[model samples]
Structures are given as C-alpha cells and as structure tokens.
Target: MFDLIVLSVFNGLIYGLLLFMLSSGLTLIFSMMGVLNFAHASVYMAGAYFAYSLTPYLGFWGALIAAPFLAGLVGAAVERFGLRHVHGHGHVAELLFTFGLAYLIEEFVHLVWGRNPLDQRPPPLLDFPLFTFAGIDFPAFKVFMIVVALGMFVALWLILTRTRIGLIVQAALTHPHTVGNLGHDVPTVFTLVFATGSALAGLAGVMGGIHLVTNPGMAQALGPIVFVVIVVGGLGSLAGALIASILIGLLQTFAIAVDASLADFLRLFGLQVTRATPGWEVWSITLAQIGPMLPYLLLVLMLMLRPRGLLGSRDS
Candidate 1:
C-alpha cells in the first residue's frame, strides 16, 4: 500500500507536468489573442509526426528541437494568412475558421502518416531507469520530462514578468491599438505569440508522443482535456491553468489508484447491492473505471460555482 502510494504520487506529478506543458501554451495564446485556437492540439500532433519523420535523419535530439520550429512556423503562417483575415468578422468567425482548420490538419496527417500510431520512443541515452522505488523502476525520460516542463514554466514566467518584451506583450494583449500607435508592430507581436504558443505545444507533443502513443488520433483524444485544463484554470490565467492542471492530474491518478465502488457506500449504511441487484450495473462501477471523467465533472462544478476559475479575475 505504501509503495502504491509512492508510485501514484510520482505518476501524478509526471502527468501533471506533462499536462502543464500543453495547457500553458493554450492559456498563453488565450491570454494574448483571446482566440481559442481549436487547431492547437492538431499542431501538437503535427509536431509528433514531424519528429517521427525527422528522427531517422536528425535523431531524437535534433527532431526534438526542429519539430517544434516547424510547427511554430506553420502556426505563424496560419495566423498571418488565415486568422488575421477572419478577425474583422467577429470571434465566431475566427472560432469557426480554427474549427475547420483543425479538421484539415487532422486529415492532412492521416493522408501523410496514415491511420496508425507511430513507433516513437525516447533516445537510448534517456531510456534507462533513473531509480527504483519499492522494486518499481522510474525512467530517466520521465525525469527529463519533468525538467523540461519546469524549465519551460520558469522561463515563461520570467519572460512574461521580468522582460521588456513581456511588458510589451501584456500591454498589447490589453491594448493592441495603443501598442500599434506606439509603432511597436502589434500585429507582429500577436503573430509571434501565436507562433511561440504553437511551438510550446509542439515541444509538448515531442515529449508526450514518446510518453504516450503517437497516433494520428492523438490530437482529438487530447483536445477536450486541454480545453478542460484551461477552462478549469481560468480561461486566460496562466497561474490558474498550472494549478488546475496539477490538480486534475493528481485527481486522476489518485482516483485510479483507489478501488472503491458505489456499492461500498451502500454497505456503509447497512445496505448491500449484489450482482443480482436491479441497479447492480451502476452500483458496481468503481472509481477507477470512471477516473477519466473526473476532470469534466470538476469542470462542470467549477463552472457552476465559480465561473472565473480558481485564479481567474473578473475580466479573465
């Protein structure tokens, strides 16, 4: 039991940080552009696919760096050519444009990569076990993932809070016209932010593809979860996004570790439901069986109780 607890904690932290990597990019885009960027996860899939294709010639390390740049470049193109044109048509048009773009990107991936999961893996250097706890081995790649995520989080925080560019970005998000009037090229700033956010998503994809599976369906699978993270964290709040990602990650891991069922609750009140019970199907459902749904449940509750989210402000 103690070992299980220890393993669960480690797993939770890993998953949480992985989630933060993805959510941070989405949240940053929202903070700056006020656009939901429905194609965000698709860009992540593109990164994973790009890495897979580049791994043979460039190897894992090269692909890790190159793939994100490719994704970011694509994102910049989409922003410059596609999104900018749709901006004057209102938010709905922009949202619909991205929604369509996501499908196009997915189809393009399917055409190129096919309907299959790639055999993506970490480099041999990072594949070995880092440590063993209670007879269970922890992989070095997970530690690397943790480091990358923390580095990104800290770097982003510093860039936003301590730099001149950061100040300009914050100001632009709130007042694009004002910044433009100051001759700072506000449009260029927005383009860079979109590209940077997409690049971060790409980086996350490269790391996560090895950690999870690199399937063509990967984007669609993770799309809802990413949205849930940002929404629960507070739409445009970076700190809120981080806290919510970790919270949801821990919640999912811990919930799956427990073997409790609704039937267990009935027994506590001197009532028991057996297989023969009329509602046995429902009562026998274990928490682990529905762990994936926990985040959505929390999302609904958060929306109902505190729509602004944990760290969100009135305007956020």
Candidate 2:
C-alpha cells in the first residue's frame, strides 16, 4: 500500500508537470498578448513531429534543441503572415484564424506523417531505472522529466519577472501605442511573444512525445485538457496554472488507482446505498471507471463558485 501510494505520487507529479509545460506556453501567450490560441496544441504536435524527423540525424539532444526553434519559427510565421493580417478584425477574427489554423496544421501533419503513431523512445542515457524504493523502480526518464519541468518553471518565472525584456513585454501588453511611441517595435514584440510561447510548447513536445505518444491525433487528445488547466488556474495566471495542473494531475492519477464506487461513499456515510436507492446506477460507478469525468466536473464547480480562478488577478 505504501509503495503504491508513493509510486502514484511520482506519477502524478510527472503528469502534472507535463501539463504545466503545455499550459505555461498558452498562459504566456494569453497573459501577454490577450490571444487564446486555439492552435497552440497544434504547435505542440508540430514540435513532436519536428523532433521525430530530426532525431535520426541529430539524436534526441539535438532534436530537443532544434525542434523548438523550428516550431517557434512556424509560430512566428503564423503570427506574422496569418494572425497579423487578421489583427484589425478584433478577437473574433483572431479566434477564427487560429481555429482554422489548427485544422490546417493537422492536415499538414496527416499528409506528412500519416495517421500512424510514431514510436519515440527515450534517449539511451536516461532510459534505465534511476532507483528502487519499497519494491518500486522509478524510470530515469520520468525523473528527468520532473527535473526539466521544474527547471522550465523557474526559468520562465525569472524571465518574466526579473528581466528588462520582461518589463517591456508586460508594459506593451497594457500600453502598446505608448510603448511603440517610446521606440519599441510593438508588432515585433507581439511576434516574439507568440514565437516564444510556441517554443515553450515545442519544448514540451520534445519530451512529451516520448513520454506520451507521437502521432497526429496527439494534439487533439491533450488540447482540451490544457485549456482546462489554464481556465481552472485562471486565464492568465502562471502560478494558478501550475497549481491547477498539479491538482488535476493528482486527481486523475489517484482516481485511476482507487477502486471505490459512489455507492461505497454513500455507505461509508451510513446512507445504506443500494439498488433501491434513487440514482443507483450513477452511484454504482467506480472512481477508476469515471476518472476522466472529474476534471470537467471540477471545471463546472469552479465556474459556478469562483469565475476568476485559483490565482487569477483579473476577471475572466
């Protein structure tokens, strides 16, 4: 029991951090540019595919470094040629452009990589077990993932809070015309933010491709969940995103592990849950069986109870 609990915690942290990696990029984009990119996950997919194509020649390390820049460049192009043209049309235009752009990216991936999943393996250096405790052997790749995720959080926080560039970026978010008059290239700043956000998503893909899957549909699978993380964490709050990601990660991991049914819960409270009781069918469902439903439920509760989100500073 102890070993199982311990192992589950590490697994939860890994899953949560993967989410943080993905959400952090989206958060950066939204917080800075006020654009909730519908195609953000597609950029993530591009990164994975980019890594898959590059790894054979450059190996994992090289792919890790190169793929993000490639993805960032792609994002920069979208912001410049695609998103930029639509900027005058307002948020609806931006949203529609990104929404359409997502489909375009998916089709491109299908045409290039086909519909099959790519078998991406961890690098040889971090492929083995790192240690064993209470009869549980933890994979080195998983450990590496946790470390990279944490390192990314620290780096992003410092970059945004402690740097001169960060100050200009934040100022631009609120006062673009003033900043532009002050000799800063506001459009260029927007492009950089989009590209950097996409780069962060690409970095997540470089690792997530191996940890999860490298396929065309991979973005579709994780995209909604990433949105949920940011919304629950608050639209533009990095700290909130981190907390929500961890909470959801832990919730889902433990939900999958626990075998208790809703009926068990009612009985625990001396409610005598049985088939004769009202809504017995729903009560009979097991936690593990309904694990995927929990996040949405939490989302609904959050919206009703606190619309601003966990650490949100402004109204959504």
Candidate 3:
C-alpha cells in the first residue's frame, strides 16, 4: 500500500504537470486576448506531428527545439490572417472560429499524417529506467518530463514577474487601451502572446506525444479536459490553473486506485447486493470503473458553488 501510494503520487504529479503545461498557455492567452482558443490542443497536436516529421531528419533533440517554433509560426499566422479578420464580429465569432479551426486542424492532420497513431518514442538516451522501487520501475523519460515541466513553470514565472515584457503583459491584461495610449503596440503584443501560447501548447504536444499516443484524435481527446483545468482553476488565472490541474490529476489518479464499489458501501449499512439484487449492476460498479467521470462531477460541483474558480480574479 505504501509503495502504491508513492507510485500513484508520483504518477499524479507527472500528469498534473503535463496538464499545467497545456493550461498555462491557454490561461495566458485568455488573460491577454479575452478569448478562449478552442483549438489550442490542435496546435498541440500539430506540434507532435511536426516533431514526428522532423525527428527522422533532425533527431529528437533537434525536433524538440524546432517543432514548437514551427507550431508558434502557424499560430501567429492564424492570428494575423484568420483571427484578426474575425475580431470585429465579437467574442462569439472568435469562439466559433476557433472551434472550426480545431476541426480544420484535425482534418489537415488526418490528410497529412493519416488517422493512424504515430510511433513517437522518446530519445534512446532517455529511454532507460531511472530506478526500481517496490517492484515499480520509474522511467527516465517521466523524470525528464517532470524536470521540463518545472523548468517551464520557473521560466514562465520569471518572464511574467521579473522581465520588462512581463510587466507590459500584466499591464495590458488590465489596461490594454491605456497601454496602447502609452504608445505600446497592443496589436503586436496580442499577436506575440498568441504565438507564445501556441508555442507552449506545442511543447506540451512534443512531450506528451512521447508519453502517450500521438494521433489525429489526440487533440479531440485532450481539448475538453484542458478546458476543465482552466475553467475549474479559473479563467485567466495562472495560479488557479496550476492548482486545479494538480487537484484534478491527483483526484483522478487516486480514484482509479480505489477498488471499492457501491456494494462495498452497502455492506457497511447491513445490505448485500448480489447478482440477484434489483440494482446489482449499478451497485457493482467500482471506483476504478467510474474514475473518468470524477472530473466532470467535480467541474459541475465547482461551477455550482464557485463559478469564479479557486484563484480566479474577480474582474476576469
């Protein structure tokens, strides 16, 4: 049990950090642009695909550096050519545009990479086991992932809190018009933020592809969950996003570890639910079986009780 607990916590942290990688960019984008980009995960997918294509020629390390920049360029193009045209139509138009963009990106990926999952293995150098504990072998790649995630977080914090551009970004978040009046090119700033956000998503994709399956469906699978992280954390709230991601990740991981069922609960109440029981099928459902449902359940509860999220700004 001790070993299981330790392993689960480690796994949860890994998953949570990955979630943060994906969510942080979205939160930043929303803070600066005041619009949610539904296709953010698609950009993540593009990154993975780009990496897959580049790895053959550039190798994993080279692809790691190149793919995200390519994805960022794509995102910049979308903002410059596509989203810029739709800004006049209001937020709804922007939302729909991104929703459509997600579909288009998926289709484009399918057209190029096909619907099949790509064989995205980590670099051979980092493919070995880091350590063995309690019959569990911790992979070097996961440790690398943790390091990468922590590094990204630190760099992001430094950029947002310690740099001149970070100060400008913070100012623009609260006073875009005033900042523009002060002679800052707000439109260029917006484009840069979008590109940076997309670049982060692409970085997530590159790492995530190594950990999970990379396919055309990857974006579709992860898109909604990423939204849940930010929404539950709070829109435009980086701290909130981080907290929510870890909370959800740990909860989901622990929930899957539980083997108890409704029948087990009923037993403590002096009841026995068997195959012959009226709702035996429902009562037999184990926590592991319903683990995936927990996030939505938590999301609903959070929305009902605290719509602004844990660390969300009141004005945002």
List per-prediction Cα lDDT, in the order shown: 0.87, 0.88, 0.88
Give the range where candidate 3 is weakest over 10 consecutive residues by summed lDDT: 307-316
lDDT of 3 by residue, 236-260 (tens): 6777888888888888898899899
TM-score each candidate. 0.94, 0.94, 0.95
Name the runs in model 2 displaced over 4 angstroms: 174-178, 276-278
Off by over 4 Å in 1: 181-183, 276-278, 314-316
Candidate 3 deviant stretches above 4 angstroms? none
lDDT value for candidate 1? Answer: 0.87
Q: Write the per-residue lDDT of candidate 2 for residues 189-232, one digit (tens) a residue.
A: 88998898899899889998999999998888878888889879
lDDT of 1 by residue, 138-237 (tens): 9999999989988998898899889988888877766778988988988888889889888988998898899988988888888888888988898666
